[model samples]
Target: MSAPYAIPRSHADWRAMAESQSFETRAFIDDAFVDAASGETFETINPATGKVLARVASCDAADAEVAVHHARAAFDRGDWSRIAPGRRKKLLLRLADLMETHKHELALLDTLDMGKPVSSSLGDMAGAIACLRYNAESIDKVYGEVAPTGEDSLGLVLREPLGVVASIVPWNFPLMMTAWKIAPALAAGNSVILKPSEKSPLSALRLAQLAKEAGLPQGVFQVLPGFGHTVGKALALSMDVNCLAFTGSTAVGKQLMQYAGQSNLKRVYLECGGKSPNIVFADCKDLDAVAENAAAAIFHNQGEVCIAGSRLLVENAIREDFIERVLKAAEGMQPGDPLNPDSFMGAIVDQTQYQRILGYIRQGVEEGAHLRSGGESVETCPGGLFISPTIFDNVTPEMVIGREEVFGPVLSVFGFDTEEEAIRMANDSLYGLAAGLWSQDIDRIMRVTRRLESGQVYVNNWAGGDMTVPFGGVKQSGNGRDKSMHSLQEYSELKTVWMSLTS
Candidate 1:
């Protein structure tokens, strides 16, 4: 058998890589790196070691306005907004090329800033590159429409770029998520203002430079690094912005929609939080495989995933057996230094998130959920924001751990008696983002796939999808699809032209 995964790098190698990077901390505005208008900056602490990495520009309302004005001017100028679709495609592909060329640097930055395993960030770079290339290639292929018209008149339906789009993305998967939001917007010819979460801003800063290198025009793309309340709120409330697309918490997503209504009522699209459910039936072909997936679904990325399968619902016949296997698999998911390429898990994003996860663990205990394994913070990495991979058994839908999103390495497990009961329990949540089911019975597969109240569903697996599929959620999880041809429509508006041919 192959040896277990380990961080390939030595301590000296990691120390060198960490010390080699320049502490670049500036806002990308008007295609230039500049400080906040008020000259204020905030410390960007490394969650892995509780050390300050850099002092990033702390952009507030005024700085956000600066970015807005710049983007508006760029949009109104029509340089990128009215450029040939083929040309826009070329620029985006060039940016993707640059990103791929610097993949290692980008991956290291993400590992240092957000505390994700370096191995995973490398994978994220691949995804981000794919998203850019996919949107780039498709830009020129998508065509406008001609509506049904009488012989004497013409009705031409056109798709035009929405002017000055503001994209507010979260900390986890920062670079990839930013690419998902902006690639289509940029390809469709919109000037984009990106507000990356303050918790992890390094990759975004690097991305801005790459965009410039790839020939994106001044003000066509910008990055503002600041608190969500400041730059994030400003972006949503800006009258000059024609659209606001956000990916973060469901609570924050709702606030953005309100801000949109309060301001220009710009079109809003959101991909928000989820407490996804993963169900396994007794008839599975292999319980071992199910147990492996169940562990990975919740433990990957240290459970920072928005669609992490935090809820595990197993049929009563195999519930006890499955929990034992899941615990065994979760043993390999210990938190380690992010720079170690082999580490399966990394530090929590921050102290606030760390404490929040611990609070949920305590709540789970109070609610009488059995602590199968892992409950407290590990002392291995004393300064790191590290929480052990935790599992709570016998969880009910009403418990806080079962209902709310902890967004950490925590799993809540429940047992169901029937397939119908499992479906009911899975659908009985405030979220409808994604769900997974495992069963060899073809009829059961068909029935469960149709009944799960989520945007995406998985059978015999969890959280695997291509760039071409639509991904988003229903209900409080937020709205609008994020990938495939549907996302292209999100950045463009429909305009109909009429001509009187008989006159």
Candidate 2:
């Protein structure tokens, strides 16, 4: 499982690869790639160039029904669902191996498709391979429970897979997020249908072909690429789909819940929006280190992360010094060509997001939040949807920029006088996916961490964790975790089997 692809050393190397890249842009159903039912195709644009890379099958409700039909047949036939765990594990491992083998191609596709820097795309691919391998290895290790009972009776608690799972992933971190949902769902022995975001569906489609090559049974794993309203809604409302796992906005998450409720009451697992707060206290041993981490928290991946630490809450004791340090760190993260090896940041996903992020920047200014550093687009990468890393100081909890999930590289800084005030400001948002705390005081760290309303908290750090930790949120951030053993539970059902020994 060592790194399978050699890292491209130059922008020319990456550009050559992107120019020659051949994408699989059709709906993969029942182990075959086919055209949409209506013969309609949508352009998969390169956000960095605003050019059409390929014409992908624009699947609709009819296509969803066909794929679901195949998935249901495969599940009912026990081709994958009832297979031995070891066999399933082997298949998934082979798929992971195939993914590793094609890591470079996948990385290039993601970069050209979504505008993330090539290095970031490669990093995401590595994480994706690890996540898949971890879930595959866990498939054979998990054991059912033997419930205690009197000698006259025997009770067993069994974990069984839900029939068919539909995973709707987001555009940001596309490959990684797809791995988060599909790995666990497939490991749990469920037939999975991945409905990746239309904005970036190239990697998912390629992975489907790899899954087929890995010898997964027909219809066991399918990729239906289309818009959420038609294909996503159809899958959510499908009577055959037993569980629906989604990672996207809170509004869309809510719509999926409604779809679930209106149809078959399918189990819905969502990892939605986050306006995560990074609280820095004066007791922090190193302001410089904290400032570096704070900058990376929001600027990495062009700040298109769902659990990004977009809110910066600083204790007033060292507010001026720390803010200055953070601004300095941000200065080095201007957007550039995604293919360039040295580019720290890349373009926004698309024109819509580009304009949306710009709108937020304008709103922040109009609402009186001081534009400290970057607040506009950068011309360094021509034709790319590149926005400069933006920071807004003097932000209030009441402001829209502070309250909403911008999903861009927009950092909103707020000043606080005490630990209580920092905690209050951090928890005032509607979302609670993740939060960060920087302090050397052990007692205050523990006390403040206990009060922060987030699923994952990083102390003295911004974001650094492996796939072993659970990732999810509270309140409006959505429910159910995505990684680790907890995600396995999301795709499985527990049942009790009681037997009378006396009989």
Candidate 3:
């Protein structure tokens, strides 16, 4: 049965109803939600309406140590790690079922905490469920290998799970990202200590409860909600943590790598930032579709995606027409309360991010780029963190707005005269997370796909994929993949067994 809170209505109705709702205090540890050790708490505000949704526990390094100790004890005792693979798989599948049952509540919590539109949060919740299920289904299927050897000798390769994993998930798509890391880690027989982003920790806390209800053993899945400087640093530096996975900015990813090296030399997997390119060729069949997709690519989730196609590389022949269409589409993107299912774009994550995006917009104009559509901050609601959908034409590849990740609804479009120039410009960024190509010609598609230096490439679309496909990046965009059987391998180590009959 669907959750009672899951209502069917237009975006407008959802927005109006959600604005009046109040949330409870949040903290999850050892299979229960509790207050911080220091008795300190913080408020999580809705950026769309600037209202406090929940008061969450504010933890520090001391709390992190407690969480880690529990995780280490659980792993050392082998309650989860020594469980049969088939049994572990069943537990994971049960968790997935529970997530489906409470989809509406989880989706609503996500929207209220992160300020993403309810529709988008619903989709994200669905994706998170799929991720957990996919990993669960693959748990028992992964097999060790036996290498061919001479007579009277045997050799076998085995995969073993790391003891305890520390997962640091970003604010954008908080629950989904956490599942991307935790599902596979747990399926592969590891205990996890998750540190959700301070900006949005409600869903993670709720997820801990759901996991417990779904039969996850105590300490097998623990959540430590706190600021990154203390709790995050503590997790990274803890010698007991066998593996560390993170999804955030490139700058922070580098820092985590350094911390990992300094501590236990633990295996680190990072999925970092990107300034992805969405290249549109003149030979594309539909300019209107390209323009619409371009707008959606940058504006979806308020442009908070690590793999957002913020850099638009267009052919000079149809550049003016394409920009006009893109601007028209941008104007139609209504930014309002996130609980509204009708609003495609919601508020920025917080006031700081709102001002940061505005600063970038102003910098683009000061750097001589043309403001094609929207740039200034929206004054609606007076306190909510909202920015108008912004598009910049006449932008160069070297502009700050073009190169750096604004992490808001900002698009920078650059024109190139030839295909060679277009590909060159598209590949001219330190980030190589994702890129898109719009072309009908088979040869052009193949050639561009081969030349473009990105981890994931899409043709005539943006951000559509199943859990089987790998997701990661190269260069400064960071290393490692998530959301596949490959992701489970990241949490495991390989061992070889050799036997000799000569003895």
Per-residue lDDT for 223 in model 2? 96
The prediction achieving the highest TM-score against the true structure is: 2
Write candidate 3's Cα lDDT for 1-503 as tens digits.
Answer: 56546464776556555655545455566777777888888788888778787778888888888888888888888878988899998999988988898787788778888889888998999899999999999989999998999989999999988999999999989899999999999999999999999899888877887888889888999888888888899999999999999999999999999999999999999999999999998898888878999999999999999988899998899989999999988887858667677778888998888888989999999999998788977765557787888999999977899889999999999999988998889999999999999998889999999998999999889987899899999999888999888898998989999999786
Residue pair clashes in candidate 1:
7-342
The parts of candidate 2 lying over 4 Å away from their true place are: 1-7
C-alpha TM-score for every candidate = 0.97, 0.98, 0.97
For model 2, name the residue pairs that clash: none
Worst lDDT 10-window in candidate 3: 17-26
Report residue 312 deviation for candidate 2 (angstroms): 0.3
Candidates in order have lDDT scores of 0.91, 0.91, 0.88
Per-residue lDDT for 386-443 in model 2, tens only? Answer: 8888999999989999999999999999999987788888899889999998888899
Candidate 3 local lDDT, residue 232 = 93
Ten residues in sequence with the least summed lDDT for candidate 2: 1-10
| Model 2 lDDT, full chain set | 0.91
Residue ranges of candidate 1 with Cα displaced over 4 Å: 1-12
- Residues 365-475, model 1: lDDT tens digits: 999999999999986565898889999999998999999999999999999999889999999999999999899999999999998999999888888887899889998
